[model samples]
Every structure is written in structure tokens, then in C-alpha cells.
Target: MLVAAGVVIAALTGSAGCYTDPGYKGRPSDAWIAQLAAPGLDGRLDAAAALGEVLRLQPNAPKVVTALVAALADTSDPVRVAAASAIRHAGRGGGRVREQLQRDAVPAVAALLADSAHPVVRTQAVAVLRDFGPDAAPTSAPALAGALSDPDPFVRRPAAEALGALGEAAQLVAASLARAATRDGDFRVRRAAAHALALVGGPPGTVGPALVGALRDTVELVREAAAEGMGQRGADGLSEWTVPAAAGAGDPMAMLRATATADPNPRVRIAAVTALGLVGDRASRPALRQALADRDATVRREAEHALSALHRRGGQDPGMEEPSRADLCRSNPGGPGC
Candidate 1:
């Protein structure tokens, strides 16, 4: 039993030091690029490794990224892997570093994703594409969506994430993602595809009703993500979903209230409450008030906060049984309402 438990623990949560990503060590000299460009193999190898670590830290300098992109072509496998690692780190800032990477590094790194010989090289290259978000969509989405069918869920999961980052521009792969979200054998791939669809095609009229449909997913995380997507796109109206007839009210608020008060998972309930708050309509007050007595303390607290916001918004019944702002502050003390 002890050995079984230990293995489960290690499998679920890897041991320490796993948090630190592998990359080049040491700071880059101003002439680090020149060193990589230098004639000697030793100098170039050392420079590539150091720059890979620097890129792991995500330095936003244009020249540094430009130089790193140049390293992607080096004949040495270490240099190519290190450069890919750095390029992955370099895209976090979302501006010039991202643009430079999109222009110069994406093609090389993406090509490395198919390297066959170096799997980590491919994984690191995929990691780099994650930072590109929507900018890499045109060049990156098709390949990423294609990976959704990979035998390894590990590869499929990150590909879904990158596609999700592409957001609306990932319209081209919406059908593929919808298929993966529902039919994929791996739970992680199903969860990731469900999540990616929320971002890629969840809006009311975009590509399809995949996000709303995800609300019924067997996976708890997928359902939670779907609720969040509905909330984000709910705006002044919840065109993404219609209130279920069983909820007895012909509005999304009815469905939200049902999901909030009755959903089994606390996270889904919390997301439903958050969506109500985001909707910020007077109709939500009754549900928020009902949620005040919810089984989960967090749900109760969230209900209090939502009611407070509703009061502030001049809800349907200011004079009803709703608590005043001061009362809410005392109830959930230290809340933003205070």
C-alpha cells in the first residue's frame, strides 16, 4: 500500500526542481550572438546554451531575440534545442519580441516540432508557440489542430492550448476541435479541446454552439470552463445559450441560477455565480439571495458579493429583502464592497 501510494503521489505531483525549465545557464554577453556566430564549435555551443537560459527568463530585447532566431539554424542539436527553448521563453511580452518571433523564429521552431529525432525539441518548440497567442494563428493553428489527433495526449493537449490562444482566428479548425472535444479518448485532450472551443468559437454567432454544449461534458473541468466562457460572452444578454425549459423561466438567468444552485461541482457553481455577477441584472438578485445559504462557504460568500453588486447596480427591487451595502460589508468583511 505504501509503495502504491508513493507511486501515485509521484505520478500526480512530480518531485521538486521540476518547476525550473531546462535552458542555457549564465548571462549573455553583448557579443553572445557573435560568439554563436564565431568560428569555433566550443564558443558557439557555450553561447547557445547561455542564451537559451536567458531566453527562458524571457528577455524582451529585439536584438537578443533576433540573434536567438538565427541560432535555430545551427547544425548542432544542442544549439537548435537551446535556441528553441529560448524562443519559447521570448514570446511572453506580446509586443516586439512576439512579432520578431512570429516573423523569424516560428517557422524554424515549428519545423523542429516535426524533428522526429528530438522529442523535447518539439515540445519546447510547441511551448514557444503558446506565447504567440493570436499572432501565430495564421501560421500555427493548422499544425496545432492537426496535433489534436496525435497518439500522445501530451502533444495533443498543448496543441489545443495554442489553438485556444488563437481565439477567433482559429475558426478554420473549429470543426476539428469540436470533434476532439467530444470524441477524443484522452480526458485531458477532451478537457483541453472543450476549453479551446470556448475561446476559439464560443461567441454567440461565431462558428457553433460548442461551448454551450460543453456544459454537459462528463469532465468537471470542461463544464467549469464552459460556464466561464458563457459568462465572458454573456454581455448584456446570454445569446450563447438558452435557458433550459426545465428551469421554468425562459431566460439565461434562469439557467445560470439553476447551474449555480444545483450543479454538483463547487467550481462550476462558483463560475455560475460569477457569471450571474457578470450579467449584473436585477433578475439575478433572487438567485444570489438564495445562494447566500449555499452548502459551500465560498458560494455563500460569492452570493453575498454578487448581491452587493446588484444592490449597487439598482437592481429590480431595491426595496425588497436584499441586504444593504453596509450589511453586506459586515457579512463578508474585507470584501471589495466595503
Candidate 2:
């Protein structure tokens, strides 16, 4: 067992200096391992990063496990996220590590689930937590449900995905997700809620109506999710809302023109203009023509290009009929986009 443990230690540590003695003369000490496991916050991201490296290197080390549990219990959010990730690796067997985490009751990990300020981190944390499976303690259920309403698309999306892992608790989460689908400020959040509903693995025929209602969502992403879900259930007669572009508020063509004419969030504006060409809403010509004159080069280009595409295609954009084969993946805006 010691030899096997040593081999695992070597495999885990690899090139890290933690495997060797301070002067390359003796076995690594508990003190050294503990130091590497300590969570650092006081603007010492490097220190936390180093500790994470050490934990990653020694998945089965009792000392490493002890240090990680301590880190998971730390007050610092970043440190907690690191420890949770490290523990996830150790717990790949799916029982002891999860039990340890549940017993720790670290709020930092929960708080990280709602950290919209950093969307990427929030998404990644949610993804890791969901792997804990249906047996995850009930104490964390409310926290996961609350995240369904997160402001950041990346944060809320993953929260939806995580809720799916809760098994029976998923019914409770579905209520929260439903509320978010209709009321959340971010369209992406609503879409995530809708997608998460499907992932519950319940009766598809019964859930179809709720998903169909989401088709009317103001944001394209939500509409897309709804449309895709409806398509999967073989529901037809989805009028007004059709491939690529769906009508809202007024005539489909007119709405597209106005959307292209106005609407903040440059990406949304651009997508709206593109939708006009796909829908072949000719009534929007005036708006599209004017959009071609806008100062923003991309918007102008999209407007002109879309107008040309519409004219050539004779209305109605192509390839809007497909639905995703799998459930919606939680948003992940790691790095800058988050």
C-alpha cells in the first residue's frame, strides 16, 4: 500500500517541486504539504494557485486531504473555489470526498455560485458542484435554487444545470427556474432556465407546454431555446415565431426593422438585423437601409449584408429548423467574457 501510495504521489506531483525535499535530499514533510495546502487571500493569488497545484498533485494523501478540507472551510471565496475543485478531484470515486465537503458546510463555495461579478468563476464552480450528484446535502439545495435568478448569464446558466443534478429536489428547482424563465432580466438566464427544465428527465410530453411558452420570451436566446424544445417534442403550428427570426409586438418584418433601428447591446442589435434577412421581412427595408449608414462599421456591414441576403433568398433565412440533441450546457464565461 505504501508503494502504491508513493506511485500515486509521484504521478500526481509530477514536475512540481512539492514532491522533492527542500534541498532535494529527503522525503516531503507534513509541514511543507500543509503550507502548500493553506488558502491565501490577502492579494496572494499566487500562493492560492500554488496550494492548488500541490493538492492536485497528491489526491490520496491524508495530509493533502486534511489541508484541502481546511481550505474548503476558509472564509476567502477564491480559496474555497480552489479547494472545492481540488476536493472534486479526490472525490472522483463519488462518496467520501462529497461527504467531507458536505460536512464542511463552507459558505464560500455557496457564495461563489452566486458570484455574478465574476461570471466565469461562478459557472465553473457550479459545474464542479453538480458532479456531487443527487445525494448532495439538502443544506446546499436552497443556495443552488437561489442561483437560478442570478444576474449574470454565465452564473445563472450553470446554476440551472447544477439543479438538474439534485434528483427529487429538481422539482423544487423547476419552480424557481420557471419563475426565472418569465421574469429574469437577462434573456440568457431565462433560456438557461428553460433548458434546465428539460434536463430534469421527466415526461417530455408534459413539459412541452411550459417550454413552448418560453418561445415568446423577448430575447432571442430564450426564444431559440423554446423553439428548439418545441421542435424536439414534435409540436407544430408555431406561428408568428418561425425559424431564425420570430415576430414580437408587431408585424414580423416591421419588428425586425425597428429592432435593427434601435436596441442597445450591439450584439443583440446585430442579431436582430440579421434576423430580418432570415425572416424576409421586407417592411423593414427602410430601417435596414438606414442601418447601413450607421457609424458602427459592423452594424452597417451586417445591415447591408443581411439586406442583400434577404433579397437573394427571397425571404426566410435557411437552417433554423434544427434542435440541440443534448440539454443546454451551463454558461461558461471563463477569463474575460464572463
Write candidate 1's Cα lDDT for 283-319 as tens digits: 7777777787889999988777777767767744654
- Model 2 ranges off by over 4 Å: 1-29, 36-51, 54-58, 73-78, 105-108, 111-124, 137-139, 165-169, 201-209, 227-338
Off by over 4 Å in 1: 1-45, 53-78, 89-100, 115-119, 165-176, 200-208, 232-257, 281-290, 318-320, 330-338
After superposition on all C-alphas, the RMSD of every candidate to the true structure, in Å, is 11.2, 13.2
**How many angstroms is residue 243 displaced in model 1 relative to the true structure, after the best TM-score fit?**
10
Instruction: Name the candidate that leads on lDDT.
Output: 1
**Which residue pairs clash within candidate 2?**
278-317
TM-score of each: 0.67, 0.49
The sequence of per-residue lDDT tens digits that candidate 2 reaches over residues 36-107 is 444436433334444445545544343454455455445455665665576566544324433444544233
Scanning candidate 1 in windows of ten residues, the lowest lDDT window is 1-10
TM-score of candidate 1 versus the correct structure, residues matched by position: 0.67
Clashes of 1: 3
